[model samples]
Target: MLAAGSGAVPPVVWVPVVAWCVAWQASLQHEVIHGHPTPSVSFNRWIAGPPLALWLSYDRYRATHLQHHVDERLTDPLDDPESFYVTERDWQAAGPVGRLVLWSLNTLVGRLVLGPPWTVVRFALSEARAVWRGDPTRRRDWIRHGVATALVAIVIDLGFGVPLWLYALAVVWPATSLMLLRSFAEHRLAADPAHRSAIVESSGPLAWLFLSNNLHALHHERPGLPWFVLPKIYRANRETVLERNGGYRLSGYAEVARRWLVTPRDHPRHPGRAS
Candidate 1:
């Protein structure tokens, strides 16, 4: 797959393939974070800590994601570290331009188009601010991230001769965008925690790509279940799963795109709390 004309990997082929690898790596990271295929946490972290996307550190992502697994805090803008929802105060503080961008990002297509850069910038800024404020944890994470990212740079740029700029723009950007596709509507604002996450009743390649995370409600309910067995478990108990989640399900990603490609799925502001 790496071969191309003139003995160099062409950008067209190289970019998409790397993006797929990176997105799949992110899925593997989620699997590793959930304690899959292994009993040792350090081993899992080591196996997935290559900075494939070059923007997020594995340890940092794992930490925030575990925090997100506090099921009762699901979709709470302040409580859930992974929530896309903005508090009313933040939404109002973001003037017209920021609000417009946030609104566009609510659409499935717009999320894939704009979410990657927006998230990376926001996360980077937050981490920078945290470090500036003398947050020791953030400082350590950034330091470790720098070392890991530098190692990845050496492998991709020096070892394989891929330019860092091309890697970032072509691989990291598109990979992050693909991740946004899975996460676009994985959760929505709801009063009940059980009702926040959705079930994507899909059995296609995207489901495999996400490692069965498309059955998001099931994964949330049983975090220790391995990816390979999720479809089996869900098939055996579909009704119970659906009933538990209040029937929040999508037929597939295509259905999601068709329904919310143009319209914003929900306002970015959390509905339960006033500004």
Candidate 2:
């Protein structure tokens, strides 16, 4: 940011750089939720505090993500907060426009271009509803995240001498898009829990940016392991992990894009969850 402000690096260049930083920050926040690099819960929490998240609060994400780890409920449309699929009731409630939007979101191109804004709006509304329902925890989290986002905005405008709109367009949106890439088809609804999560063997810069979450199945299988060690462990247990997950793997994000860019991978409605 300083480089960009000082005109040392062009804004065009810094845009992607800042975006990558924010996206990597999210992966670090993921580590925080899982108790990584330290044993002290307080330390872990504060260490990765303030996700600079334009959408969800850290506490809110933490609570829901922990619940999402329950293997039995991996793709439970109603139960999993991160689930891409929706229940039949949810589909019916969406009407037509909402249904079409859901359909678009399931495609790779749509997810890259449209997912961030949709997630922001949807999650904000959900959080606001929770606050209206007298959830004090949600209230506090919202307030804190609101303050944090404001501080970041200030830094961008005042300290860095960059326009707020530029910051959002350059930094925030791209970061969210990058995250969407990793999560695009990250999981599938399967009878076996192990088969639900996917392995994206993309060892490119994104692998590091995502903190090795490309090895997602291993992360799920050993939630306690730190990101740095995932590759080593996965390599050692490759056959076993592959067998366990029933070969739920992909080559990389490139493959994901090739396969699902225009076509939807699956319907928005969850299979076997219609009732």
Candidate 3:
């Protein structure tokens, strides 16, 4: 907060540093949801601190992501809360503009450019509907999320000298986009439950940003293991990991970009249930 607020901070470094912090907080949120640094889930959440992503509800994410770990439900459009695919019924229900938007999101370029806002808007609308329906859980989630995000804004905007708008654009948006890159191809549609998750063999800075989750298949296989140990464990059982995931591996995010930047990574429609 201080670096970006301070006039003396590096011109280029402030944006990325702040952005990395936001993204790191998001990774921390994921870790907290997975029961990290403590046995108490509530304490872990407080330690995870403010909702840096601003648009998301950590409570809601916790509920959904735990559900996402059900391997059999891995990429099921109807079951996986985080599934990128849509059911044939929904696809057929969507009009031309909506279909085009879904098609664009299937590409890495469009995911980077459009995913965050789309996610935020869709999430907000869903939450609004839930609130309207008098869902107490959604009400509490958003209430807490809103207050926490406001606290973050106050600390950055008022306590420090940074503007919320600038922070949202430079830090939050890029942070969200970076997050999308990690998730962009983390899973694939596969018949075998083990093969649904993918492995990205990247040990660089981005891996740290994702808390070593770039070794994704292993993370799914051993979600209880702490992030720091994932690499060591993965190395020890590299061949087994490869075999378990049916060799669904990528060299790195660079390869992901090379393959799917413009090309659609997969149909937005879940092929197994497609019309």
Candidate 4:
């Protein structure tokens, strides 16, 4: 049903609401991938595959994210696909403005304000360049992604009667907000793989929103465990888990917002040495 006052509601409200729902659905996909909601992996993927988050393929993320759990090479710039660190050489190569932009993205506000644009634009440009160069991997990735992109365009154009660009701006901005919150303090490139992931001690409302992924250490340790069961397992092993993570814990997002809203968590130069 079309909401009666939705048309008059500010873009801020609808944008965030759509983004939050999408983010929650993405969390559900993560849960499905971890064998939650069913024993059948393919079935779970089917249900969770529609959203096509950050324009990424769910199967591809599953493969890469599982490798990330290996814990032996937590945030090695090359080995960890999710590393945010720039190599010293790259740091030196950056211009003044480039360096400033990099630093800004290292903070919470920057991640929300600038991260989405940076990520999407960079990826699209790189993909275009790769296509020009005839990169097979890029081709295959895009071929799979193209189908979903077309579907997303059709839904926005036909269903909402909104221009593709407007729909994108509306969806991507607030979706990145949700992503930033989940990932903002999830890790800090520790010396040990076991200690690499951070723990949000009490996520409360956000925990359910993230499908209990706030208990990230537990998820990393046992990815097969269902989302609903994670809280129970975490509670049972809270002391051990905290010790294993080298006391890298936060009260919640409020405390996280208070401490690191504008500050860098650690020096960008700190090598994520395996301990």
Candidate 2 off by > 4 Å: 6-8
Q: How close is candidate 3 to the true structure, as a TM-score?
A: 0.93
What does candidate 4's lDDT look like per residue over 1-275, in tens digits? 03412366666667667777777877887787677798787788778867535465665556556767777776665566556666776666777898888888788888778878876665567557867899887678777778887897676667666566665677766676677678878877766778888778774878988888888887888888888888888889999999998888888888888887898765554353322
**Comparing candidate 3 with candidate 4, which one achieves the higher TM-score?**
3
TM accuracy, model 2: 0.94
User: For residues 99-129, what per-residue lDDT tens digits would candidate 2 score against the true structure?
Assistant: 9989999999999889989878877787788
Give the per-residue lDDT of model 1 (tens digit) for 72-142: 98888777878888888899899999999999999987898899999898878877887899999888988
Arrange candidates by TM-score, descending. 1, 2, 3, 4
RMSD of each: 1.7, 1.6, 1.8, 3.0
Per-model tally of clashing residue pairs? 0, 0, 0, 1
TM-score of each: 0.95, 0.94, 0.93, 0.88
Q: Note the Cα lDDT for every prediction shown.
A: 0.87, 0.86, 0.87, 0.73
Clashing pairs in 1: none
- Candidate 3 lDDT over 162-264, as tens digits, reads 8888888878788888888999999998889999899999989999899988898999998998898899999999999999999999999999999999999
Q: Return the lDDT, model 4, position 204.
A: 80
